[model samples]
Target chain A: MAIAALAGFVGALTGLGGGIIITPALTLLFGVDIRYAIGATLVGVIATSSGAAAAYVREGYTNIRIGLFLEIATTLGAIEGAILATAVPTSALAVIFGTVLLYSAWQTARPGPVSAAAAAPDPLAARLRMNSTYPTPEGPRAYQVQGVGYGFGLMAGAGAISGLLGIGSGAFKVLAMDRAMKLPFKVSTTTSNFMIGVTAAASAGVYLNRGYIDPGLAMPVMLGVLAGSSLGARLLAAARTKVLRALFGLVLVFIAIQMIYSGLKGAL
Target chain B: MSRDGGARRWTDERIEKLVGNLLRAGVLISAAVVLVSGICYLWHAGTGAAEYHFFHGEPSPLNSVSGILASLRTLDCRASIQFGILLLMATPVARVAAAALGFYLQGDRTYVVVSLAVLAILALSLSGYWVR
Candidate 1:
């Protein structure tokens, strides 16, 4: 319970999926069943989303319109992914999901341009009025949105990954909103928070139908993550970004190596 | 320099207006749906055939409604349908509450619409129209 809480706290801070940390810890460290671990992770995802999204919305950083529009794609994709999960082999899913997580971790570690290039406004963004400014330490700043279609497409992919792997995929969603749509980091982060719950909920329904959700496992994880993430969000503003990023990178590398080793051993 | 300043100020006004329009439309629709759904559920509580199993751990068919209104009854269902309902309710409540807060903090009308949209989705989902 303490380890799960700690993992949730770190996950909330870094916008990483608590499952990426918790599932392995539970199964590898605690010797819990993998099915139970997945179920617990789903609950953690819900808890993190509910807690963080509420605060993000209150802070006025979440682009609710964009989040809602993208959810259509994500929700549908999530259902499909859940369906696939039951049909696919567990080992295959684990290896693919781990590879994807590692790639996402690598992408997050590399710095990217914060602002969009000067060019013709994307037609989809222009239609939706997705371009907007956000509050910063300086003042309200302007940002241009681009690639709405592409961003939504990425969200669909991310949603599928989340459903199949029982992971959050906020990193990928953030990348879409931040890089492709050129939203401010705060907006992207908050929007990711808002979208994650709905994405998870969509698959959660399917998981429930398939009997993947175990209430005993889910209860402890949900309660732990909700408590831990609430504390983490309170601490987010005061924490140093560089230090957090370094810690996040280190955790990702460790998890990735562990996953690779586990996959190879299983294969062998 | 003064002309550039004037142009910038004018653009800001236009931008604000556009955002305001979107927000107003979004919030009004979303909130109405949520409020109505919540009211309907409460209204139907008296005579509806819906079962109210508090601590149901697993899903099963219930012919008659069983209302467990107290906190102690929460553990009757295996997965807790009541808890699921509460969880479902949280999304809209949070959305509306957040939008209201956003309005107070940023004075942005868009927040209001965002709140409503969140509620609308919840209401629609709860309606069971899309469940199948």
Candidate 2:
């Protein structure tokens, strides 16, 4: 529970989910099965994502239209991925998890990403009426959405990762919306937060049904994450998070290496 | 971007606020249920060794809603925790369903369909009607 709270606090500050820390920690430190770790981490992921989204949505940073549209792809992919989770070899899953963790560390260690607003709206986006505005110091500023097809495809991939690994995959979601679809960074981040809950819910249902969700472990993690993320959000404005994010990234790198080593040696 | 941009923005804000409040309520209620039930669980089984190193899936009854509800009648704390988790899962489904209704009211037929499609997938998963 303490580890969960710490993971939740750091993950919220870094714009990730507790799963990245929770899963590896459970497997390596506590001797929990990888599948059970994933199931419980997923519960924490939903709590943090949905809890944070409540604040983000009210602040007008969320793009509900884009979020809902992308969820069609995400939900479909999540169910497929959840089904695959039960069938995939545990070693292979560990290796994949480690590799993804490496990628997440790289992403976090990098400098903050700039928004990729489009010069012109994609015709498909315009036709679908997916273009929208976000609030700014000046006023509500209009931004065009582009690469709808590519963004949708990436969102589906993000969902698959979320289900298979039981992580929020928020970084990938931001990559889809900000880098692919060219929404503003704040818009992408908050909108990704909004979509995370739905995407996780889709796979969580399958996990629950398949008996992957053990309530004894899941409930405490959920409560811990919810409490930690809420406090993290409150502290965000006052906290100098640069050093903290870099430190968190370094920790992920260490965890990733250990996970890969364990996977290769079949110690898991 | 369009002539009705201002009106659309207003509607979006209202809907966003409503969605925000709804999500907050869901999280709070879920947390409360989980907290209460988790305490009961620890009280009953705190001294037992945790059996999570192996990946045995849950029992047949605990995996389904009907079974969980039945367990709750006997004051089984584990089932109560599952019930809370069920509520947590349902929160997002409710959000999607509300969005579908909102879009329908807004007359954005395309997004309404889009939201419904997502909701359908959620429904299938919750019902355990999908491929095992």
Predicted structure with the largest TM-score when compared to the true one: 2
Per-residue CA lDDT of candidate 2, range B14-87, in tens? 87888888899999998999999999999999789789989999997888777888888988999999999888
Q: CA RMSD for every model? A: 9.7, 3.2
Question: What TM-score should be assigned to candidate 2?
Answer: 0.89
lDDT string for model 2 (A92-170, tens) is 7668777877987787687754544426678998898778887777889988899999999998988887888787877
How would you encode candidate 1's per-residue C-alpha lDDT over A168-238 as one tens digit per residue? 77777877886778776567766786677767766665555444555445655665676677677667656
lDDT of each: 0.60, 0.81
Query: Which regions of candidate 2 deviate over 4 angstroms?
Result: A100-115, A235-259, B1-10
State the number of backbone clashes in model 1. 17
Candidate 2 chain A least-lDDT 10 residues = A111-120
Query: Which parts of model 1 are misplaced by more than 4 Å?
Result: A114-120, A240-248, B1-132
